[model samples]
Target: MTLAELTAAQRHRVIAGTFTDRVRATKSWDAAAPVAGWTARDVVRHLVEWFPGFLAGGAGIELPRGPGVDEDPVAAWQTHADAVQAVLDDPATPGRTFANPHIGELPLDQAVDRFYTTDVFMHTWDLARATGQDDRLDADYAELLVTGMEPMEELMRSSGQYGPRVPVPAGADAQTRLLGFIGRDPSWCPS
Candidate 1:
């Protein structure tokens, strides 16, 4: 099945698994990442730090806290990812409602899938790039996200969640276009 066709649980398993892989492969937590002023650890830090509060506020779900990113990024990510996966895996969670002021209400799983998991998918490239690992993302999924976000460009830009879009070459590949859409330079490498 296409990544977009996967159930929320299945999608998280795939997207989060890639982030987990990048986490495991990370050799320098302090390495400079593609995001301006964010370290490799900050990539994990952003994911682990942001989602729990969003989940709690929206769905009343509290994910377990683990090692601090400063202390151990790998353990921090593993704990956070495992907690998120467990929530998705819970039989009781699929039907839960998530209510947010900005986005209104959605099924808890869909909320996580739409906001949190996609963030993880994009940040996977940051972590991988920082660590000098393979940074390729699923092309189909990248195209899907860019197409979905293009219409929301103004709102997203105003939210400050993304930076200004970077320009890519004519007819750039899906992944490259995605990187640019998300305000990352597809050609970025650590200095």
Candidate 2:
């Protein structure tokens, strides 16, 4: 379904929650891939860092000052999660705006779903390798990955942002293929 087709509740319940399930598993061998100097705990902290900004004023929040409270690193994570859940619960907040990278224009609801779709989908492996949980991927999500990203593979790879492609095993599942293409070492971690 196109992004406009989904509701805020669905975005929060299905999409965002799924991302939480996925990202909560990520761990880095060096303990900092998800965020500088942070492990899996730190990665969640990172996503939580930006959670509140997704709803902007939709959460009935004053704009948080600065990049948030960095000293209390885990607090930023907790606050962001609570704020994101609040946006999902409030029907009036769908049209809100969230800040993000290269996402262009979109309302709060769409952005929230997109955040779940893009970040969680890819990071499923980032966490897998970072923490060594490759066998634990959600199979259902892996199947839909092609619909979400394959057609634009060449374009994304050519942009120098996604980087040179990695070859996929012949006839592998879509998730493995997509992860390999996006500069992740499907067979090795932290390459």
Candidate 3:
């Protein structure tokens, strides 16, 4: 099913599953990633470290702690993704509200789906590229995201979440346009 056609839980499962596959496939946690100074391990670390506070602060939902990324990137990511899935799977979570100073209030599921799950999806490419694996994103979903974000480019850049858009060829594929819009060089590789 298309990303827009999936429920929030299903969306997270699909996107996070791709990221988990990349995490498991990684052979070098310390390898430099496409994002300037970040390593493969750092990609997982960013997902693991950032979301818990946002979840807790907004929804009062605390994710269980897992092994450090330095110790085991696979286990660390698995734990974090599982915890997020559990929250999504919880029956009560659908009705819950998530509110924080920054984004105000949104359904807990939408908040997670919009912010955390999508982050995992994008970073899957980072982890994959860092370790020389398949780095292609789902083209339809990439198109969907780029289409949705195009109107918000100025705000997205101002938020410092996205960098200045990089130029890509006019006939570039959806994923290439997405990477360029997000300030990622579509052809990046570890040195």
TM-scores vs. true structure, each candidate: 0.98, 0.62, 0.97
What's the CA RMSD of model 2 in angstroms?
5.4
Best by the lDDT measure: 1
**Ten contiguous residues with the weakest lDDT in model 2:** 27-36
Candidate 2 colliding pairs, count: 4
Q: lDDT per prediction? A: 0.93, 0.54, 0.90
The parts of candidate 3 lying over 4 Å away from their true place are none
Q: What is the per-residue lDDT of model 2 for residues 137-163, given as tens digits with 9 covering 90 to 100? A: 444555555556668787666756565
Better of 1 and 3 by lDDT: 1
Ranking by TM-score: 1, 3, 2
Q: Which regions of candidate 2 are displaced past 4 Å?
A: 1-8, 14-42, 45-75, 95-105, 154-161
Model 2 misses residue 123 by how many Å? 1.7
Query: Could you tell which candidate, 2 or 3, scores higher by TM-score?
Result: 3
Q: What value does the lDDT take at residue 56 in candidate 3?
A: 91
lDDT score of residue 85 within candidate 2: 63
Q: Report backbone clashes per prediction.
A: 0, 4, 0
RMSD to the hidden true structure, all candidates: 0.8, 5.4, 0.9
